[model samples]
Each structure stands twice: as structure tokens, then as C-alpha cells.
Target chain A: MKPIIEITDLYFSYDNKNLAINNLNLIIYEKEWVAILGHNGSGKSTLAKLLIGLLEPLRGTIKVNDKILSQETVYDIRRETGIVFQNPDNQFVGSTVADDIAFGMENQQISREEMKKRIDKYIKKVRMEAYLQHEPHLLSGGQKQRVAIAGALAMDTKVLVFDEATSMLDPQGREDINTLIQELKNDGDKTIISITHDIKEAMLADRVVVMKEGTVVATGKPTEILKDETLMKDCGLDVPLTVKLSQELKKYNIINDIYVNQEDLVKSLWEYSLIK
Target chain B: MGIQFDKVNYLYARGTSQEKAALIDIDLNIDLNDFIAIIGHTGSGKSTLIQHMNAILQPTSGVVKILDKTIIGGRKNRDINIVRKRVGLVFQFPEYQLFEETVEKDIMFGPLNFGVTKEESAIKAREALKWVGLDQDLLQRSPLNLSGGQMRRVAIAGILAMEPDVLVLDEPIAGLDPQGQKEMMEMFYNLHVNQQKTIILVTHDMNYVAQYANRIIVLNEGRIGFDGNTWDLFANYELIKKYHLDLPDITKLIIDIENKLGIELDHKINTVENLAQALVQALGGANHVR
Candidate 1:
């Protein structure tokens, strides 16, 4: 439960008049998967930028691995953090998947032999070893994202952020990425932050932080945060379908408690059905 | 006027080794005022099919009749602009294409390009703004300075200003939040219901298809795999699996509950409310539960 990323009294504004991140405070523990939910212009992306040293905060501090983010330590901070963005077409820098992955490690002054070995190991980890030589343009959106995740993992960063990563993908592609995230969580070694609009994606997180008007409105377990329809609406999100069903059943006294996951809810309903 | 596509075949990089067929033997008859949802996997020729609606990409070996215009493959056609003006195709993430300094100017740009008078285009701009549920005060603001959701609405307003008969939206709500997605979908649905505008939407979200679209057209590998009512499309579990399509979340939940509880629930229920009612009835009636 060691804090890996700590933000204190963070403030940032793009226009110098309106605050994008207003007095925000948060701490992400090591090996924790936190999903940040917010509507557009709620400053989710700004926070992601500030964390990896892409944008300097106007006030307060962001500490990654206990090192405060500043001009001098920005490079050191960035080396330990990696981010995969929304658009897959814009993130490619190499002619092939293998080269794109090696590009990051090479910047760290890793030797050719070690770089090759790490690339091979991480590519297989993300399940993209078969498409090692495929061009970026030839790969599907889901495949490109897998490669991106592979690239980030290849860097051996402690903190990995996905900024609306699966938003642009198809359902199957999204499933693949979500599965990869689950596997990464099971490994319990890297801290993952997913900023997404999909409630199903947030349901997979260890913690959920809901933002509205550039500030944290609610923070708790995904089941607790997502079950409150009012808070979800305030943050411009819809409750997941399973939760809605459970709530309705609860009102009719058909079920005693609300369930977030599909399987558990269905199981509860099945047990209830056997009553009569 | 409706659109008619006849055995259309489109090939990219034609006559080269790199040439690939993007659309093949496509025949579709889209009536006026039809709300159709086009769906399939990525790279399933959905984009290529919609691009033909506005002559953005003409077919290689077939005929396309849009409104009063006819485009024949391998033949000279000079009315591409006329077809484009009548069938407005909004690309995915269309906000990225917004470059005008002001929102008003951006919306008017399309109408002005089509030879509308400045005064007339201004009027159209305000009307289009209303259509997309934006305030008139935003007219003077820079399009780039607005939030992502506003920028997207302004981009759609640009298309509406053109007064197109057929509105084709490509993944219009892909990156939007849950509420933004609901708002945009409602806006399109209103345009279809109240304004009598034809909406041909391309989306990966079957939830929207189940809720809004009356008709569904599924494409697979540059060909039409299924074309029919939404109910008929979702009824076949095998077809849905074969196309790698996902059911609406509510529908999926209902099917899961039926299987887990060993009860027969209606597969046509697409909303949470209806699903709850059905579940209660299946699990020994609401009266019995009470």
C-alpha cells in the first residue's frame, strides 16, 4: 500500500482565468489500477499531462516515486512513467512494431543486446509477438494499442497511464485491451491509471475517481461510486446497465442488494428465482 | 429523394500490385426519411460504403443514384458537388476539421462554398445552431476555444447548415462521455423524427442501434452480410457471433439471466426498464415477490 504517485493541492489553468485542475489531491498506491472518470473539459487529460511532466502545474506538486516533479527532475520522472493516448494513428514513430518498442528503450541508453531481449519479452507479454514486423498502418486499432502498451511496458516504467486509450477502438478491440489491463493488474507490479468514458472500463479498476468541473466529486470503490446514479449524472456519466437493472429489482423487493458485475447479479437473480 | 446503389465495387490503388477492393457488389436502396444504422468490425468496408453516399469515393464498377443525380462507374460525372450538398457525410471526429475563426463563420462556410449569399448563409448558421441545441451567443466565439463537446456540435452544425436531405454520421459518439453520447444520439434521433431527415449512422455501439435505428445494415469483408429490421438482426445469435458483433448491454443481460435461471425471457427487450419487468415476471411474478 505504498503511495506511488502523490498529488497535493494541484492547480492548472489553460486560459489563466478558468481552472482546469482545481485544488486536486490524490494518491495512487503501487500496483493500483485507478480509473479517472469525467466529461470532456473536466481536466482529466490535463492531470494526465501534469503527472508525466508534459504540462507544468501552476501551483502545488506531483510526486512520483517520492520525487517532486520539476524542471530538473522532469526527465527522471518521465523515464519512470509512460502514457498511451486516445488516437492510435498519432502515436506511431517507427516503421514497424519492433522498432517502435525499441525506440523507447534505446533512449535510455540500453545496449542493443539487452534492448532486443526486453523487446522480445514485452512484445510477447502484450501478445503482439506474431505481429512484430507489421507496419503501423497495417495493424488494426486494437493491435496498435497493444503495441503501444507493449512499448510502455518495454520502457520498464513504474506508472502507466492510458488516456482514453480504448475509446476509439471497436468492441472486440476494447475487449482485448481490457483483458490486457486485467492481466497486468493480476501481475500486481505496475501502477495503472485509465482515463475513460466507458463505465465497463471503470468497473475493472481497483478504485474510481469521478471528476466534475475540474475537481474530484466522488472517490471510492467502483461498485460504490457507480451505483449512485446522481453522482454519475453530475459527472456526466451513465450508470452501467447491470446496476440499473439491480436498482429496479431492488425497488420491487426482487433483490436485496445492488450488484455491479454481470455474473454476480445474474447469480443473485437465479437464486431468487428458485424461491418460488 | 432516396439513394440507390447498384452492384457497386470500389478498389483502392486500382491497377497496381497494392490494389485492394474496399467494397464489392454492394446494392442498397435507402428510402427518404429512413433511419439506418450501418455496423461491422473495423476495416469492414463501412467507411467506403458511406463515402459513396456523397460521391467522396465513387464506385469502380457500379451505379450510384443520389437524389436527382446518377453516377456510373468508369464514366464521366460532373455533378459530384450536387450529390455532396444533398447528402451530408460527417466524418468521425469531425471537430478536427473545424478551422474557421468563429463558430458562425464555420457553420456558414459550407453554405457559402455552395454559392449561398452571405446574408442567407448567416440565417442558415443560426438555424443550424438551433438544430444542434447550441446557444446563439456562441456564434462569435472561436471554434477552437470551445470545449471538445461544443466543438463537436459546432462541427455538426456546419453540416446541418448545408440543408442536406440525407445526414450520414460516422461513429458520431465514439469518444464522448456517457451523457454527451446520450445527448448527441438524441439530437440525431430528433432530427430523424421531427425534421424528417434521413440518418445513416455508422457505429460500433449496438446499444444505439437497438435504441434508435429502425433498420440495420451489417457489412462484412466489403459485402452486405445482413440488411433488415433491428429486431430481426438481433434475433439470430449465430449471425451476431459470426459478424463479431456485440449485443446491446441490456439485451445481453436479459439473455444471461434467462440462461442462468433456466427461464425463457424475451430476447427483444432492449431497455433496462423492460428487462426488469420481464425478470420479475420470470422470477415468480411481481405480486408473488411483493
Candidate 2:
């Protein structure tokens, strides 16, 4: 797998005294969906901003598509990356849905005809074609997020970052965005990075990176990282319900395994119960 | 004493083309020391219903009774602030409302506005800070300088300073991380248990409903779709689906096992230990396991 984005010895601090991102090193491969999991003030969101050139790192380097990030190449780097913020209401720059989707492409110097075609195609892809003319403020939180995603994808960026994108939405809205993320993963073309504290959302990603206190604590497949209850606790996260149940069952010798997802755990328990 | 709502209906943008009903005919009685979880999807009238608890919004065609005070629809009501003082309603994202330069001043703001002396309000502020589990050293620091979780607690401390009998929280744990969410939930549960404070929490997360609350009220399109204990609500799968409600994770897992394995399992299991015990029994007791 070719590395799409690479970081080396990265360091950043909001104040001169405190290092928000402390000697962090990471590499995300092409077409990979990586979930950066952390508690509040753990510096996961700061890393997202650093990747998109929104914040300059105090030390080290970030390489995107084999090019290092710097003042000279910041614009070029930003053009290749797109990010969706936590609050949908604060991200809107256009009055209408269609206009919002076209705003990024317009900055890219795309022609009117091509911009219209891309907006039409991407808006429909997000299932918001009917809301082409609706003002963003009139839309629901979930709908506004979909429009924001459509805008990001319409720009044809190679990487997309969601910075706590679903945290503020209602449960149903959060589920809808998760479904969209699942669909995007199946397409297997864009590199996706989701910064969140939700274990359920992290379970859907191809890889999970757990951060604590401005550093990487663990990196592995979702099941490997999530099954370690001690590690999750150390990082200030409670394991998901299924994992908790699996651990309890293991304690009773009712089952000899730990299952991360609900389906697998339920199936294994059923099989175990059938033992005569 | 507690709050009572009678045939309450609320309309937004009244007398205009865009005028619409945000709440419909509703009747509810909240008793003293009740820990109620109000749940529904967005725009399900949960906020509108809670607003009536504090007289922030009056009913359009009904009545709201809080303790001995009564607010009749379309009629002039005096001393609305009295109801506000007793029933503290914490809005969603309340941290945004913190404006005082110091955390102490922010906590004292609510009490000071209600005619408490500065010295007395300062005492209340310190006590409320203890309830929120914040360090007293933060009293002199700016509210904006704190972390996100600390900011949220300081904001809640401000409400507690008012010495309200009934606490109404609108998605209090919405943007918090998992650990922060757990801490906030436990804090509220403690307030309900030790302080005997009435907690009316509006949330969409059903897991909290199953674990914390004794009573649950579900709103569907401005009407009471279901009002009962957690077990009964979860047993009615049809109502759960109709109102777009999610089952508690443990209950959902047990139901799935029952369906897929063709076995009988209790539907009332709410915690991991309870579910595991049920599964062990379903396998013909503890002797079945090696």
C-alpha cells in the first residue's frame, strides 16, 4: 500500500509552554479509513487541523502525495485535502445547498459548466438533489452535514477529514452520517480520516489509532484496540456495550473469547450455549 | 410539590403564514423527587415541554401548575421569575452562555440576579462548585481558559447556584467525550439521590434511560407516544420503531440472540452483568459451563 499522507516527529503547541501534539508520527495509506480516537484535550483535533494546513506545526514535517507541507506548498496541500468541522451551522459559507457545493470548486478555477455538472452529480450522490435550492439554515443538522460532505467531495480532493463531525447531531442523524461513511468506505477510492471519541464510529473504520495526552497510545484494527479494556480505560474511554458483555461472559467461563462487535459476540454466545 | 401540565399546546410564529404547532394537547404530572427521562427525536416537542416547566414559555391553550403557582394559557401571569427560580432549565450547549470573567462570578450570576446579597451568593457559588466537582482554585480563572469539559461543569454550577428544586437539562452530555459523559451522568444521578432534587433530562440516548432513570416519557410529533418504566417501553418494539427510538444495547443483543438461536431470553436485562447472568441460565445454569 502506498502512503497517501506521512508525518514525522510532528510537534505543535497552542501556548509556548504546552505541547498539544508531542513528537507524533503517523502514516495513512491511500484509500484507508482511519479513526483517530481520543478524549477531550487529547490533541486529535489539533492533528486534523495540522494536516490541512490550518495550523503550522512548531517542528517536524507533513508530507502529502510525496510533497512536504510548508508556507510555499500550503495552498497546494489544502487543495488536495478537505475537512468537515464539528458544527455544521458554523461551516456554511453559501446561502443555498447548491451554492455551497459549488463554492470549493469555484475557488479551484473550474469552469461554470464543469462546476454545475460536478455539483449536480455530488449533490445527488449525497441524496440531496431535492434540496438544491434550500437555504442551509432551514435544513436539519443531518441534512446540513450531508450538504457539507457533498461540498467537500465535489472539490475532488484526494483526502477527506471529519473532525468530530457527528458528535453534535441527534442519534438518528449520527447514524445517518455513519451510514454515509460506510458507503464511502465501500467505494474504496478516497482516504478518509475521522477524529472522534465514539467507539461505535471507530468500529467502522479500517484502522483505529488511539491517542492520549498528546501522543499515540495504540494503533491497530478496531477489534484489537477496542478489546483491551485496560487500554481503553487508560485513554479515558469506556469499551462498547458488546465488549463489556463479552468480558463479563468470559469471567463466568461461559465464553472463552472476546468479541468487539454485537453480531459476532451474539453469534458466539449462541454457539457456546448449544454445547451439550 | 411538583409540576403539572394540563392540555398544553404551544404554537410558534403565531398568526403568520408560517405559524405551526410545536406542541399539542398534553397532560403530565411530575411529582417531587422524580427522576424522569424525556426522550424523542429532534423536533419532537421535548424542548417545548421542558420550557413550560420553568414558565419560560406559556401554553397556548392550557395550564401549567408548578407547586402552588399556576400559569393559564392566554392569561397574564405574574412572578414568572419565581417559577424560574424553583425550576432551573439548563439549555443545550449552555457553556456558550458563560460570559463572566471569572468562574466564580459566572456561578454567582444567577443567584445575584435573584436578589441574593453578594456575600451570600459567593457562598452559594462555592457550594455549587463543589457539587460540580470543579477545583476551587478555578474560581479566579477565566471561564474561557478552562478545558471543554471544565467549562461545561462551570456552566452547570451556575444553574445549581440558584438553589432550584427541579433541574431540567437539555442534552447535557451531547458534545462531551465518553468519560466526560459518564462523569456528568453520575453527577446528575447523585444529585437526584443525595440531594433529592428532581431531574428532568431530555436526551436521545436510550442507554441512559435504561440505566439511570426510573420513569421515561417519549414524545412523538408533539404527543405522548409512550410513558412508562424502561422495561415496558423496550418491550413494545413497534412503538419504539414508530417513534424512531433505539433499544438499549444490551436489550437489543438479547433480542437478537433469542431470534437467531430460537431460544427464550428475558427482555428486561439492562446491564452487562444481568445479561450475562441470563445467558448463563439459558444455557441450563452454571453447571453447563466448563
Best by DockQ: 1
Worst 10 residues of 1 chain A by lDDT: A267-276
- Candidate 1 chain B, run of 10 with poorest lDDT: B281-290
For candidate 1, lDDT tens digit of each residue in A157-196?
Answer: 9999999999999888899999999999899888999998
- Over 4 Å off in model 2, which ranges? B287-290
Task: Give Cα distance to truth, residue B97, candidate 2, Å.
Answer: 1.2
- Model 2 misses residue B8 by how many Å? 0.8
Q: Estimate, for each residue in B156-270, the C-alpha lDDT of model 2 and write its tens digit.
A: 9999999999999999999899999999999999999998899999987788888898889999899998888878888778888788788887778888889877888878877
Docking level for model 2: medium
Candidate 1 runs further than 4 Å off:
B287-290
Across residues A50-139, which tens digit of lDDT does each residue of candidate 2 receive?
A: 999999999999999999999999989988899999998898888889988988888889999999999888888889999999999999
lDDT of 2 at B157: 95
Docking class of 1: medium
